[model samples]
Target chain A: MSDWAQLKQALISGDGEELCRRVRQTLDQGVSAKDILNQALIPAMDVVGERMENEDMFIPEVLMAAKAMSAAVEILKPLLAADDLSAAGKVVIGTVKGDLHDIGKNLVAMMMESAGFEVKDLGVDVAPETFVAAARDNGAQLVCLSALLTTTMPMMKETVAALESSGLRDKVKVMVGGAPVTRAFAASINADGYAPDAGSAAKLAKSLVQ
Target chain B: MKSKGRRGGIYRPLTQDQVETIHDAALTILERVGFTYESGLDDLLEMLEGSGARVDREKARIAFPRSLVEAQTAKAPNRVILYGRSEDSHLDLQDDLVHLGTGGAAIKIVDPENGTARPSTLKDVYDLARLVDKLDNIHFYLRPCIPTDIPEAAYDVNVFYACFKGTRKHVMAGVNNEKSFHDVLELAALLADGMDALKARPFFSIITSFAISPLKFCTQSTRIMREANRHGIPVALSCAPMAGSTSPITMAGTLAQIHAEQLAGITVCQLTQPGAPVLYGGIPGMANLKTMGYLGGAVECGMMNAAIHQMAAHVGVPNYNSAGLSDAKIPDAQAGWEKALTIVLAAMGGSNYVHHAAGMLESMLAVAYEQFVIDDEIIGMSCKVLEGIPVDADRLALEVIESVGPGGNFMTSPHTMAHLHDEYFEGNGITDRKSRPKWEKDGAADAWARARRLVERLLSGEETPYISESLDRQIRERFEILL
Candidate 1:
């Protein structure tokens, strides 16, 4: 098989070490970093996403593939142009203040990154101001808020208001999610979109940016 | 409501020979592997050494002989009655008599209004107890949530006080230490008018989680267990060994290990005070190897717990095992099926005190108010399964069939009218059976929404404290009743 095909198979099989070695080898063979990322990594991740949506791939396998894809991307990062990165979108994500849950938020971040979005994860217990500052600094097109507690859901609303008050709300699409967050809750809080889980969150983010 | 303690050994997950083999394996484990204790439990070590156990002082491990284990297992009471303040709420745990109740020390509760979790507080404890009081199918009220809002020193008393104030059902909770155990007992005595009367019925019980998994005893809990047994207070010797992490991964292996741990605990309790009331508390769970977390709702967990009931029965003691748990974070379809599958198996296998059967969600990390209401219906249905088809002459309805011969309608028959409520399991309004149009007219509420409405109605209806005015005043006077 060709070098790109070998790299793609390594990523789909979730062999991070093998994928990174192949990325280095393909680069040595005069393959452009951007070509490797676009032709091999992104397509492989797209296949992984489709498999996940089809229920052929579960969370663990998807996560492994995401890890392998990221590892290969890390090896190609220095050679690729800045504009070549984040070809999908720039996004900021976090668990709202007073909510220390981050597992769901982290999953969304990983899935988004694997889907080619540049995710700046402002970890758990993140304040509205921190989210606003991160969105402003990153020039993010989308902001995702997560809150596992009912008490901290108000923080999600406040973060949205902060973004609006910061005059960045019109520029950024705010998406909300968590265990307790519903579509009605998202609409009530004036969020631009809502997704029940991580995979759908990534899909919604892609569509929102479009 | 049907009676609580119905005979329920209909579904034996383990055969009689399997039970014997497991029992013999447990005996071998106790005789050979032994159990390790903390260094400071000098009294416990001395007692075990005096009672025919081989104690390696340097190792702080005590190995029981087969004869000692057999003798101590025989000493445990065949019957244990966890009495409620109201006489009708008593749970008679003996033979294959089955009772299901709430059990956990979860730190979070899903808010009833908005379907999200918050740190559980003292008020949540009282409120859940009150909810359990009104739930007919939940036979007892084990403290379901921790009062995180209270100070550590005040936790035990306040939790017991809240439960006592909220429900007259037989309340059980884990104590912090020997001091807290005495304080809770004193509080129960004040409610019972004296310590002697309180001891007689012991409306409340202690769940002494004395053993850490894998043949090790926690120091403080062991002390508390000894004190509880010495006072003739009913105690459940809780030893939960996570399969693949704490105990062996195989079901039979986990059973063998937990059985030995329980036998070790029983030996200790009997040696402390001969014939002390104790329940074989075997809460065996699987480990989510991905996260190394407790997998409470697996069918294997239910099967192992059901097998534990058989092991306890073999040793001639009532068992306190777990079922009706779910990994689902919400009261959705996953939660419903997981809870139902585990609970039915545990109840059918005749677990004497099946807990974690109500209100628990998120793998015992959280409880929801609506979930409790929903689980009440689930428990009601499981109990119906335990009731089984009484295949007698009356239930066979031979004469009634003859009377309603030739395709006659039984719906209009007097026999149908007589056995209407008695025969079938009348659910508690949570299950939706309405036609499509009628359901749409009623706003199409799902089980969660229906249960939430029931919760709101029950919580708002009235404020009837289980404790009387005088008793409340007396309890407040003596104790710092935070609830």
Candidate 2:
């Protein structure tokens, strides 16, 4: 098979090791790293994303495909031109303070990464100050906050408030989620967008950035 | 399922080993992961300690031994009866009985008058109950819409009163708080003629979400469940664990976590009042990973709840499960398909009380009058399916078949005349069974348009409600009677 076919085939199979190997071989063949990523790797996850939206794919499979994309992206990161490095916008994500849940947040981070965005997961029980600092440090264009508990849902408001107070609210789009978070709740907290799960979160991140 | 067409149903998606695997995992989860009690639940923590479960007081986490959970679970009743105002409407819930009904606290209603959506009021609640009373297939009334306009203090009484006055079919609602729970109990006593009488023949039951998802207890709802238990009122322990969000991503994993939560909630109820009549409610919703909506429309949702019914049956308790709630915003083809798919699964699986079977739309955010009528027709059709094919000499119709042998027409046969009404699917709403030319002659009405007409017809002055004029007046004089 052609090396490009090998890259696409590796992506579909979610073979992280093979995806990285294919990226390396393609680079060795004198192909541009940007072309390998944008043509083979990035578009591969987009297929996974579309399949998921179409219910043709599921969570574990998407996660596996994301793992493959991440493996290939790591190989292309150093060699890619700077413009291709920021091909997808940067996002800062975390579970809000007083909420320790991370599964959903981590899925969002992985989905964002797989969707070609640069993601910095701030981990669980993240305070408002930490979010503002991470967004500043990472130059993130989108901030994603998650909370599993209704009591901790209020912390999302505080985090959004922190951004406003830090004068960075205008510079970035904010998204809120968790089991208890609703579209009405997100709007009430002055959030830029709300997605029910990780795939939509990635879609929202892309829409917000564009 | 002693009814006419009870098939000894064996829809086993999970084998004995798989069920055991889930059961063992649940016990391990309780032992290791434990549950976090919401604040102000020190009494619950104390209860756990007394039961020999480990309690981390400061962190509000409690872990239980498998034996303690099993013993408490074993104390729950195997059979429960929910009475209608009239004796015929009563529900005798067992592992095999399937009761289809409507359930939601929908804040909005698509107005039947003008087909516009608006905030629901106490009258909407009362009217919906009246319509439920009229529908032959909708088995129970669970206050499909929330009376959002009522005052907080009087909401419980008024809501209960509206439902009671509208239909005698068993009404179920969750008390807003412990105090309102007592208030509604008092109102129930008045309707039953006394507190003891109400306890003796409780027509109403409480559906309480005593536990939060991922094995934690919500303090306030737990308190209400306690009050309902102590008062000898039957209750349903409803735990809605959203898959891929609150619970595990795998549907099987979600069921395991759900089984653990349901068992724990049942344990609490039994601990409070031994042999308390409680239904094990495991409404495992899907967090449609794409939308993050707590959806109950998928066929897998039907399978999960059916499996939940089986799990609760395993624990020897009547199961209260949800189905027929569509993610569709309107009563389109999507609504019909989603509702039918889920309700049939629950029914075939033998869930005792399968709710959200009517009127629920937009992922339980809103209800519609036309949708209720359409769902009533769906329920009628699905009930026929649940009545699995009967095998009897008479049903086999040897004589009739012999008489009509060799393609002789059964159209004029006596057996056809006798059995046709009961045997066939007699859909009432706009299912569009008519041919195109005839349908055009009859105005070419869609399901929505036909449903609206049925709603209007059912709400007409001809049908008398279960509540008597004199009794309603007496109750009104006693309570606020906001409606």
Candidate 3:
């Protein structure tokens, strides 16, 4: 099989160890790290993201693909410089404070990466300042905040305001989602967009960047 | 020395020893694998310390308190009557065919065809109210949470008012806090015109949860349960403990743990008021260890509901379990088989009330707006099964049978219409005997898609009964917010 096709097949099946080994082999064979990522990993993940959007892929499959992609990305992270990484737009994401839900945020982050974006996953229970700092430090063009609990949704709005306060609101468009988030809430919070699911979140992120 | 027939029919009451064994098994669950408490960690730890249970401070795991278990068990009620907004809506505790109506799926729909499944709008709430009003078998309505879009505080109040306006029957809703609880009570009081009226007719039941490990209660939820009980309002203590996680892997083990937790809540309610109305409601589902997911399939959920119903019957308290639900979306063969299996067993096993009778799909991860009609049909079929075989002479109707004779259609018989309500439940919208050409002419809408159109029809017009604009504003303004 061709090297790109082999890597694409490996990523789709979530062969994490194989993905890492293949990436290393491709790089050793004089293939650029950027080429391996753009040519093999990104396009493969885009297909996975599309499948998830069409309901052809469910939680477990998407999760596996994300894990495999993460393994492949880890191998390439050091080789690609900050400027080289911007081929995919930079996006910052986190689960708001007082809510420990990370699965939805993680899924969105995975899909975003698959759709060819560099993601700064801030992890769960992230304070507002933490998100603002992540966006600033990563030069992120888009901010995605998620909160699953009804009690913690206010934190998402607070994070958005913090971004605005830091004069980063216009520079970085903000989006929010979770079980409790609604398009009405997004409009109320003055968010750039709201996506109901992980796949939609990725699509919205791509659209925002463009 | 009894005959086989006599032995088969004999009532071998559960011995005190057998009850103690069950009690012991539950205590083991508490002592071994502690229950998960989201809030109230500090309070639960304190309670554990007071009850002489070993507490792991960091993890908040507590060893079981056997003495406390005995004390709580002593206070649990064997039976109680649940009241509605009117005395006429009361559900009597007995072994009979009782069809507690259905509630839609609580989860958000990710991909809807026409209308968006954004956080539930007022339109969704109003539509649900009207649908509940139309379903005859539904004795009570459960205000399923529109979790995604609306503010939880406003969501609670909106659902309570909707249910109150739509039906004179009872409801199960979650109040936001003490203030919301007070406001709902005040509204109920107004509808009845005072505390006396409220006592005579309890419109809604607040759900309470018990601390699983040491068998204690959360301070706020317990407070609401106590207050509701003091005012003679019924409560449903939902102990949704996950097996292999919160309780035990074994079904029997999980049930005993659930029983102990429910008894703890019941004991507290009775402590506040001796004859406090309460429903023994819990969904102690066993986890599929391989998948680490709760199997919401027919066999597992059906058995769980049946077991709980059996235990509740032992106490003579009405059961408010869930039924007419399926793991499938769209009315496929699996949906049909599972829905039929769930409702039939739950109804025949004598569950006094079952919620989730319609519009739930994907293991309750989403509510299919269109599936509600199909679910209603399933509820009707299950209720029909519970009617049992009518052997009476009037039902036999020898003369009517003679006129119909062998191989004759009952459609033209005069006796058919007379016993129609008794013989069969008339299906709503879904069941049809139309020929292909006629059916094709009318637009062949699938059950799910048809339910969607039905929901739109219900939502289009008609204000809820007796809910004046002034009263609604009064109820909306009433709030008790903490933090």
Candidate 4:
């Protein structure tokens, strides 16, 4: 089969070694890095994601598959940078202050990357101002805040307030998520958007950026 | 110390007398003021008549005997071990706290391409079973809902049977259906058949839920409960009321409504077969008035769970409640935060039983596999909290403290090793122990991926309790022909 098909299969089957080698080979062949990424790698992740949502594959399989895609992406990163192929959008994401959990934020970030967004992961225990500074520094169009605690949902509002106070609220949209955050909560906290999971977050990020 | 007004929005902390007062008030309403007739509760009146309760058949109002309620409440286990369907399935419910479980599938469908939101199947059942097996704090497994795979009519029974195969010790929340109930009993009898020779006991019991608020029972669930009672099986009269929908908006009002419903359930069970065991149970959720969405982990829901547990204790009945459920989606900070608060509060509040230990989100409309992993960790924390402060001489560790007191590290100390097993909390298995570098080296893992790995490991490595092949065939036949 063609090189693109080979790359796609590597992604679907979660073959890390082939993914890395093929990604580097594609780069050496002077294939446009963006096309290799958007057409081959991202779409492959999307397929795996779809299979996951459908239960055709469970989490371990999807995770292993994602790992392969990640390895391929790692190999393509410097080449894409050298080619000046910038991501579609920049976004900042993290679980808010006083919360140690990061899985949801990490998942959203992974899916966001797969969707072609350059995500600056702020990590857990990110203060409100930290989120604002990251959004400003990264020139991120969307600020995604996650909190898994009921007590800390109030902090989401604080983060929003901090953004609004910093005059960056108008330039950037804020998206709040986690188990306790509802669409109504997003609205209540004056957030730009809310998605329940990584898969939906990818779709939401795409919509917001566009 | 008597803080006035609402301390936690929907809930106001109450004294033991106040909680009992609420229960009494609800019982009086159930007996005298009566409740409205929903689609299925009309049968409750007939059932009451059959059970020798005074039912105003014309109005469908029933007067329950207080003595019967008290008696059935007494028969309920203050604390009982929920055995798995095999030698492996049993967790002792120490009268101090409730254990939580995740939902069985409510709806099933065809699998999707993405690893998330996929249509559930029997494989999903096996996946969840393994997840449940690794959860020491989960203590119980709610038949995780999977409606996409099975027909809607058979969803409950199918999920229950699937979970039955996954667990060996803890009680599986089997469906409360006439057919499924009988099928499960047959499976139980089969498992117990050879136990007489070995002096071992059977695994599994029946847990039937009821709709509380406008006090009554669903005809189908009631029939199942009646049959379960007749068979001398333990019953959990779970009354889940979405506040402002089935229950009044106020937490006190909601609590009273549930109490009356629970007492009515107790009365019905007793009248069915005097001395039938039934847990004073409820799984009430709060309603978000603005969105009309139900809230499961609201502070009010936790407080109500505590109050109900206290009420059950007062009547000398074991309690069942909703705990360890976070409204947050994904196992993130909000999920962790809410789960931690609720689990800690409920465990400390004298709850004898709890539900929703894992796999719930979006007001319980869905279950995230990763969240289950996080919840297990939260439950581990709660169990540690439940273990309370160890006060033994070794726990004091004066010598260890003095030996390591000045500047020495305790990491390699003999005392540290001696106490570490009992003193240190190893966390529920879901926690990521690797450092950031290691995590990055391993591809920046997430809870969903970890939980998936854990589930697979348990399914492949652990031997879940299973009935004999002959018994298994018999169960399949019964479900095929009878159900």
Question: What tens digits encode model 1's per-residue C-alpha lDDT throughout B178-254?
Answer: 99999999999888889999889999889989898899989999999999998989999999988877898789999
**True-vs-predicted CA distance for residue A163, candidate 2, Å:** 5.5
| Interface RMSD, one decimal, each candidate | 6.2, 3.1, 6.9, 13.6
Give the alpha carbon lDDT tens digit for every residue of A1-210 in model 3: 299999998999888988889999999999988888888998898888777766666556677888998888888989987665566699999999888888778888878877778889989999999999999998999999999887899998899899889999989989999987999999998999999888878888888889
lDDT of 2 by residue, A4-110 (tens): 67788788778888888878888888898888877877677777766766666666667778888877777877887775766789889999999888888888888
What are the candidates' C-alpha RMSDs? 8.4, 5.2, 7.5, 21.5
Docking quality band of candidate 4, CAPRI definitions: incorrect
Q: Rank the candidates by DockQ, best first.
A: 2, 3, 1, 4
Tens-digit lDDT track of model 2 for B1-483 = 112123313565677788888888888898898898768887777777898899987777888899999999999999999988886688888867778898988888988778777889999898898888888788899998888887767888899998988888899998889888887888888778888888998999999998889888988899999888998889999999889978987888999999999888988898888998999988988886655567879889888988887788888999888999898888888998999998877778888888899999989889998888888888777778766577788889999889899868788998888887777777665577788999899898888988888888888857465666777788788778888
lDDT by residue for model 3 (B1-483), tens? 100000010121234465556656656666566444445446445644665657776664555566664554445555445566554565554554355565543556533465445445555555566676665555666765464444556656666766777666667776656677777777677667686866765666787654443344466676667677777777777766657655666677766877767655655565566667787776655553332344455566666776676666555566667766666655566776777777666666666667775666656555655566666777667666654567878787898878888988789687888877656567777766789888778697555566666766755667556566676566556642111
Give candidate 4 misplaced runs (Cα > 4 Å): A1-210, B1-13, B36-53, B65-81, B85-88, B92-94, B108-115, B153-157, B174-176, B194-202, B401-407, B446-449, B459-465, B468-483
TM-score against truth, every candidate: 0.73, 0.79, 0.71, 0.62
Candidate 1: regions farther than 4 A off: A1-210
Error at B251, model 3, angstroms: 9.1
State candidate 4's DockQ: 0.01
Q: What share of the true interface contacts does each candidate keep?
A: 0.00, 0.15, 0.00, 0.00
lDDT of 1 at B84: 94
Give the whole-model CA lDDT for all candidates, comma-separated: 0.89, 0.85, 0.68, 0.68
Off by over 4 Å in 2: A1-13, A26-57, A71-210, B1-39, B54-63, B106-123, B147-158, B242-257, B284-295, B300-304, B327-329, B362-366, B384-438, B462-483
DockQ-wise, the better of 1 and 3 is 3
